[model samples]
Target: MDHNNMITKFDESKYLISMAPVEKVLEAGYYLNLNDQSNVLDLCCGYGEMLKLWGEAYGINGKGVDICDEFIKKGNERLEQSNLNHKIDLVCQDVKEFKTDEQYDVACLIGEVIFGDVSGTIQALDPFLKEGGKIVIGEPYYKQKDVPQALIEFEGDLLTLEGLYDTFKRSGYYVSYMAGCTDNEWERYISWSARRDLEWLRSHPKDKGFDNKEKWIDTWYKMYFNYRRPYEGWALFILEKI
Candidate 1:
């Protein structure tokens, strides 16, 4: 596969423009009994967007951690720009290795799971939760089978909804509720992302080593963006530690 081209196209277009899903998810989480005294940890919190949204609306003290330095940096910058920097903390650290001196009332692992080495990933974050704490996980169910096709194609370890819930259960966590997003979420996501990505590619022509921008664009629209089974939509599993 043309990794460079693929990365360039996806990052430049899909990543740059997508925001509705995060907003919608935060809206959903906000109504779930969050409060001012709540100490929240946003696992895999890319750019702290969710943290900012929830923190501002709910008065929750939020801290975010992501494996990507760029994400951490951008998150900090956005928090500062919003004048909520005092309430938000950003950490650039690997999720599997980062340790916290404090526990949180609520924790989130939103849309950033990449599938490999997940057992360790689950174990690492499990300790950060306070007793009976809540954890909100976001995942896609783009296929009907036990495994999602996107996961297999990307060499990702696909965890079924039952499997993930089971992992939490064996760890003494139980599901509180599960919500299915609208199909519009997925459609809007692809549409926005594809547009943003094209702009990013224009500005970052040489960043990802893509020599043929046209071919990159073609592959993205043809295979990557156009792929994926129609499901309405992603699943949000709200789990509570026992």
Candidate 2:
């Protein structure tokens, strides 16, 4: 199967697609101060939950860009059924290549889609934000300075919390509101992810990459408990374009 197909399966059971504090997701959405007229651009929006939340709670109009057509189609259908189709649109496309001439009141990059780095992401997304608009980014961070070589590929070489501030300033963004995932939350999310992988493998034991995937399951848990758990974190940060 292609990479996107695997992604669809791996994340099929997930709704919002972030390990960040789930309740805080809505709080960060509220910080956008959206209304019926507000426009949001959600990059890598999974299952369209963010837009759905904003639309239902704050009555915002928005567009979501994701590479998964299955996800986008389901989201669009639900929106149409709820009489929300007029306000929200979900398009299937690689977010990095997504384009639009229109500017939005808020631009969001949530979960697993930072194209290069946070700074590069800000530059790529800056052109789409209105002058006073806010950008909400939710992703992982390296919690410790001593890095594990094995985790780097999956870790994204993330910034420490302090370094993130420097990065925000470097990208000409002003930090507004932020929420960090608790250790309990991280443990819960990681364990849940492992469970999902295990469940997939159990039913598809004969799948082509079973051996490789099985190895990953063992490695992931081993690395998490030993290296990642104490040294990594997820957070949602709202930034203002400076």
Candidate 3:
């Protein structure tokens, strides 16, 4: 069914992939006090919207890596249109294998922990961060401990806010700042994503993956609406290496 391709199609034209509100994203950059001299690295940088916004806001230079070719292409187009291609570099590659010799003033893994574990991902990213640099992570936390088993399986070892903080602290990082998504914001994101998928499904009824796409959309909508929306809390955490 080319599930990856279908998902990419569903996400077409969207900017931010995470549950974070656009204002929250801008607030994160402001909280970090990023300047023109700041160099940023964004892993799993979907469509490069956050980096582009930061570049325009703070004049920061950034490098973004994502595995989606369509997203990278769109990001490049946006950069070129904004005359920001020289300021920001967008590459299509799996972040786990993305290598860079230079260190960054800021590194981010927004809503994606491709390294399979949050602590492990942070450890892997540590070498790319310059001294005193900040790392930003956008992740979902369990709102309560007694979530459904299916939801828990979908989320994979999520923790409470306190646990998330302790994880960073134990990993030798300090939590400098955090911004959480409002319930309204989370609902809007999920609803919008599901709507987009439904719209695509309606328009592509004759496509080879039609049945699979429809099933995927229905299942995803049910899972998110019935479980994630009520039990999951999403947040952006800014950490500094201690």
Top-scoring candidate (lDDT): 3
Q: All candidates' lDDT scores?
A: 0.66, 0.80, 0.85
Return the candidate ranking by TM-score, descending.
3, 2, 1
TM-score: model 1 vs. ground truth: 0.75
TM-score of every candidate relative to the true structure: 0.75, 0.86, 0.89
CA displacement after TM-score superposition, residue 132 of candidate 1 (Å): 1.5
The digit string of per-residue lDDT tens for model 3 on 1-242 reads 89996674344425777777666777899999988999999999988988988887789999999999988999999888888999999999989899889999999998876787779878977889989988999878998878899997777779888888888988899988898888777877777777878888889889998888888877887888899888889899999965
Best by TM-score: 3
Better of 1 and 2 by TM-score: 2
Residue 19 miss distance in model 1 (angstroms): 8.2
Candidate 1 local lDDT, 6-36, one digit each (tens): 7744443333223345545556566457777
Clashing pairs in 3: none
- The pairs that clash in candidate 2 are none
Off by over 4 Å in 1: 1-24, 114-119, 146-151, 155-157, 204-208, 212-217, 224-226, 231-233
**75 in model 1: Cα distance from truth in Å?**
2.3
* Candidate 2 lDDT for residue 69: 90
Ranked candidates, highest lDDT first: 3, 2, 1
Output the worst ten-in-a-row residue range by lDDT, candidate 3.
Answer: 5-14
Error of 3 at 158 (Å): 1.2
